[model samples]
Target: MISKKIGLVESIASKSNGLDDIRVKINGEIQRAYNYPKLTGEVNIGDEVVLNTTAVELSLGTGGYHFVISNLNNMESNFTPGGHIMKLRYTPLQVKVDAVEEQESPYHDAIEEFESLENMPVVVGTLHSMLTPFVASYKRNNPSKKLVYIMTDGASLPIYLSKNVDTLKNKKLIDSTITIGNAFGGDYECINIYTALITAKEILKADVVFVSMGPGIAGTGTKYGFTGIEQGPILDAVKKLKGMPVAIPRVSFADQRDRHMGISHHSLTVLNDIVNVEVNIPITTYEDEKLDVVKRQIETKELDKKHHIVYINNKNTEEDLNYFGLSVRSMGRNYQQDKEFFDAASSAAYYLMEVCDDSRRENY
Candidate 1:
């Protein structure tokens, strides 16, 4: 019952890391399509391609692009060495990956050795864009720290879709990556967030961990209908594992929507009602008027009672970003356009530094 269509490749827009963003002509209509070269091989113009058009037909946000299922011109498949555990099962191109927690996995011993996170700082954010600022800020302050990124499957499935990850990895801003759930193409593939956390602490020896989805977060403009709701469960998992959960609040004054005006409804809803465990929510210092909106939201939602609301000065976040030569944009707004959003992430990073310093003092 899944909607599919056969199209002709009109042109290739861009190609990177075995994925292609291309234009296809279907039934005399031009449509955008994503082609994974590893699956269907490199597609060329005039090639007939099969596409999954269900999402595009429904006009779903963040799911508008059609996926190339097969190329009539290329009918070869490549099977690589991985575990028997499959992701995107029952579908074409279902991949077998070596999940670290699996009994037959080579990294299985690492999980047994892992007992606790040892209060390792884990920064949880709702949006993918938050990863850059948080990691950039933390790396700028703690240059020697080893940071690991754990990406959940709440958004894009392939880690290659994230240019930020590519940039951060190349620049050594983040030490490694772990993709969880149906998401694939990380340095290491994990079955879920829990194992990914353990891998970060035990095997990767991560000093700090950043958890978020890849780019293109889906929102339905209704309560509990957004992809960002995953933040609640991620925070719970971090706490359940004895890791320090530092939440990156989504604050934006530049946004035109009222629900996301001060502290985003996404963050507020997750902290206020969804997450059961207490987390550290960091708010960057802003003007009293701007800060008032956040304070009012906290009071209205009683987030203060549920979570630890910490105020931090993140005025130097821009400098940290510039120091790393990193430029980030969220919802089409640049750092200057969305200062509150970036600062909120940076503040969480700053709080992690405080946690690390406190732990070091205790050890000394």
Candidate 2:
């Protein structure tokens, strides 16, 4: 049974993109809570609300916030038109979306006509923080290119939870978004990653595609036991569809953990042991002892021999980010604090830019 508790809303902290961050008092204790206005409608001060406290009760690292289940004052249900197929089936909020592959879907013809990704460059990253830097850098270098983001359900289920995504879309950094596999709230909804990729190529007419989870990646501090393991299969999916797979290696020297330093264990594990397909791994030029550490890790894992390791100069990434008026942070560290992290993502974008330019020259 799920543990739930009734709480009184003490104050509304902030509201954005259909989510409300509120302060609540439950059993004489103050707790932070998140409320989805789409489901429960708008909540207010002094309203009594029911919360799913299972994660918080277990001290789970679910961002340390309880989820607002329902407000006693508002019990109205909100429904939208969708197909017969249901995602999250048997759950209370189980929803049917008009998946593009569905026969009854309006996009069925376009989806059927889509034969391949046409060697479209798809950048796959393990963290949501990788989204902004890559998109901003790509847009800065090639302003005319149309980029689409395909968010997988490996992390946060609700796409609205990502404030970075909202900022990127508002600034026109990304052309559109598609949420797949039980993740909700995007410009379009797809049943799976394959359909999402097709939508990017056929419908959106995107020049490049970026794939990552929303936010709050789950890690168990053990090899092969993290949510980011999905990157392995996603790389395979892109290759099977004839798309060019450019992997964003999660590089960091600021992290205190040994597992996360240099090329993160997550990236090494996925690339070396998990993903079987050949992927383009880009490493940025950096002058530091940590660079040697990363090189040793790559050589030891045989990543250089297995994958096409490309060296890129991302020295201008800071300039591009500044031009777009965007600042990004991962694990609470900014660009200055975590330069290698952002540089790794920017290097992938740089590689894509070169590929696009080369293709254009050939076409001309």
Candidate 3:
């Protein structure tokens, strides 16, 4: 029994005319017998026998050269004809833009105005972060009576911080502003920011909810929570809220990796697909079992207003985080390029909420 793997001959040194005298052996057993008219047998066993190799070309294959072996006479004699054969074929890839932006309702004219020349929205990091610029930006374009920031965290912390900077709490704006956020954990903490506002039906129940995955300390700078993998628990909460998410572009791109497993499911969008998009929320526990559940949530919006309150498994590999950060920096021109896209998407959502506040008041 010959157990040796076969090797294809590419070329031979001599051009002796013996078209049917070629012989090949494996483990002392003859495997192939053929003749090459222009090839000589005066070569060592391990010598590279260059043959007329053919390239296998087909669609859906990466464009690269591959050698081909066939049992044809004079196969080792046609190097010039077979060596340059192209093996792989090429196919074009397509990308579709799924987002769209629309104009604000005229109702906003009653409560506020927009920036003089800037159509883009302002950035508000979190409740505890600076409020002056966001609030001032809104007020500059609109009348005071109609201007307001819907509160999420019921605590007076945002108000206190604002007062410290001489921006008095506009009692009227406070009244108009909507408050959302679960004093206790709820199904959709982020959605609660909206549902709570909608439940009030107040003109400014919610302007925007800055979402961050938790179990980490709440503070500004590079230390806040809500990294990529933490998405699972937050998304579980969202599933219960009957609300969609507003994911940023970078997050969307990363989430695609897990789409096949259904762990990174749900291409959620909000505000007519202009503000936010909810993409891949990771698997919490026994992720393999929950794949169908995640897929169900993504494929069909079967679950309604049932918020699922969950505690985040705060364990994270700091090494992985650092590695991802390094990779992002290496792939892009700068770190901000990776972060900026998501930031802009979030800002768009905030702008949508700000504009909607004015219109909601007119209808109220």
Task: Point to the candidate with the largest TM-score.
Answer: 2
Off by over 4 Å in 3: 1-124, 153-168, 171-194, 199-364
Name the runs in model 2 displaced over 4 angstroms: 358-364
In the range 239-325, model 1's lDDT, one tens digit per residue, is 898888888888999999998999988888899889989998888879899999889999998999988888887788899999989
Error of 1 at 186 (Å): 0.8
* Ranked candidates (TM-score, high to low): 2, 1, 3
Candidate 3 per-residue lDDT, tens place, 261-344, comes to 222222222111212322322222223344345435544642222221121121222222232221222122222433322322
Greater lDDT among 1 and 3 belongs to 1
Candidate lDDT scores, in order, read: 0.88, 0.87, 0.28
Worst 10 residues of 1 by lDDT: 355-364
Cand. 1 TM to true fold = 0.92
lDDT of 1 at 246: 81
Candidate 1 regions with alpha-carbon error over 4 angstroms: 27-31, 57-59, 358-364
295: Cα error in model 3, Å? 31
lDDT of 2 at 271: 98
Per-prediction backbone clash count: 0, 0, 20
